[model samples]
Target: MWHDKSVAFRLVRKKDVQETGELEAQARVDRRTKNLTKRLQPGNIAVINHSDIDRVSAEALVECKPRAVLNAAKSTSGRYPNLGPGILETAGIPLIDDLGPEIMDIREGDILHIEDARVYRGDELIAEGTVQTEETIAASQEAARAGMSVQLKAFATNTMEYVEREQDLIFDGVGVPDVKTNFEGRHVLVVVRGYRYKEDLAALRPYIREYKPIMIGVDGGADAILEEGFQLDMIVGDMDSVSDKALTSGAEIIVHAYRDGRAPGRKRVQDLGVEHVVFPVTGTSEDVAMLLADDKGAQLIVAVGTHNTLIEFLDKGRSGMASTFLTRLAIGGKLIDAKGVSQLYRSRISNWQIFFLVVAGCVAIVAALAATATGHALFGLISTWFGDIVHWFATLF
Candidate 1:
């Protein structure tokens, strides 16, 4: 499933590191890996400042096909077995760990040489860090598992705090802003650009067709829906990662604001002059989208690419994940994942339909054949054969 690590990641091999003078590539620097990835081109080196990088960020880096990743912070801080380092290693990308904050000083488009895991500009060596290998990543991940209990305990505490704070919104749906797009009595497809989202959304094409779901995209997920050529009805998120094209897409926007009503996304939406509402709730945007759908009386909420597991929530690296747990509990009966619906909800073709289709096909072939000149002779021969077969059967009986 992984490419050869020795291909580009041979910097770990001391002898081979000297064999290849140094791997030089253009640097794309950003404190945030996700933001940097948007501008990242193939073969460009990514310089980021993420600690214990999550799975989504790692996958984004891999998708950009970065030749190498130079992190300014720890890639895996032995915290809850975060899947980032392992993902980067498995993708054959060199993850140079914790080169220091000075690594961020490398300007975008600056050509840097990576020799024995040391980043140098021309004659000047700027930074040096550990060249993460498969063994190291695996070891870190194994050690990180012990921290899972700690993470879980913290998550439980946060969940309780959030539930207490948002009791009215969670239990009574007191402040869920109404959207123009009616979800009442309809199946709402809430898309989040999470694990296998594109693939899972593609898998739900037939479901989308049959149910004509009210498609809602959470953050960058709006672009995913647009990419699939589906008509997006509503978009729910902070409006940071989403494209301007999506904001101006005429979809009803519901900006998830902070508890105090500081809606930064509202300004962007207002500037676009599009119809939007701000729902000041203290939870993740995906949770808000689901809660809105459920509040609006959506018959069913089908989630695509949502983080469901303990590991996934941990990978998100946010205390807000507790809201997801509580949100699921709030609307578990009305909600289903895309994979679940794909597996359990078969296409609604009836047995009668299949029988009629077979019969119709046979009739069409027989009628066409009978309309020919040789058809009369063929029918006579068929009748004779049928009589002979019946006579033989009668004798056997």
Candidate 2:
């Protein structure tokens, strides 16, 4: 009877196997890829609704080490050469694109399995999409390069419109509110969540330690500064990207209430009971931070993770990239980029500092001499002897 029961259990196990999946893993879904990545674990599938995914976003995903990425929307829509799809492919992570909106319906923590392009829940197929490989991503990027001219033309038009409307703001520094942080004659480092920010910040650690500049983190960049073990002096951005801990980290918060960023930006800060200054600007928060630094007399502004190349703006898909040019023009030569500055100049104990230390020590000797009358008589005698020697030396010459 025990042998018969064992055979029945085996049959039941076999039946369940046919109904279940071979490559089962939990699903982590979010419409916003950035928010999802915060809790995304290794060996878990990431379901996102990102379209034309940019490089920075892709880099964030790769860092999370997800098993597979399922995009509900197209990863590359031939708009421009977006680097996210290729980055995921090169990292050896399975990227299934255009899985349709139904993939988002998969409950969070649901045990899911992926086979080829298809995603399944037990025996039922949930969603299917085109699997991205190296060849497909390369072809898509090549095709996307052709769209750059169109993007450029649009960028120029947007830039021109911005200049016409915000001429007073950029040149006159209008609407840049005063901050509690004293930036006068001090080096200010403004960090943004763009380009190679992680590496740039790593490079600037020496500079940061030596200069002890006022640290201003723009949005997610605030988290970057805290991660580096430095106190964040200021955070300039809409309230969406930064952590609540950063808001309460004693850094003066400046909320960028841009055209559409006004209401939601203010409310989030209010909910968190974070006291903030609302500066309504027309351009990006990074630009606004630079302008504020320039207006408040920052001696040298070192920028990190900012857009320095044309391809970068395109990669981020920002049409208002011309604002970057305008902001630089407004700040003149005082603002310098920190991307390669670390490689160019490593901070060290300089000769000037040593010289100043010696000078400080000499001050005491001078003070001691001035306090005694005998010191004055000795100075006079030494001067007469030195004058006679100078006269004899002149006769010999």
- lDDT: which candidate is best? 1
Each model's lDDT comes to 0.86, 0.83
Question: What is the lDDT, from 0 to 100, of the residue 152 in candidate 1?
Answer: 79
Which residue pairs collide in model 1, if any? none
Q: Weakest 10 consecutive residues, lDDT, candidate 2?
A: 1-10
lDDT of 1 by residue, 1-397 (tens): 1122222325442222323333668889999877898999988889999999988899999999987899999898887788888788778678898899999899888887777778887779899888887777778888988788898788889988998898899878998876788888999999998887887898889889998999999999999999999999999999988999999988988998999999998888888888888899887899999999999899999999898998888777777888998899999789987744445556699999999999999999999889997988899999999999999999998
Per-residue lDDT of model 2, residues 1-397, tens digit only? 0001111101011212322223457889999988998899877888999989888888889998877788999999998888898788777677889999999999999877677678887778999898787777888999999988998888889889999978888888776787899999999999998867877898888888999999999999999999989889999987788899989898999988765445467888888888889888777788889999988989999999888676777766667778887888878899888775546666687999989989988998877876899888887889999999999999998
| Candidate 2 off by > 4 Å | 1-22, 340-397
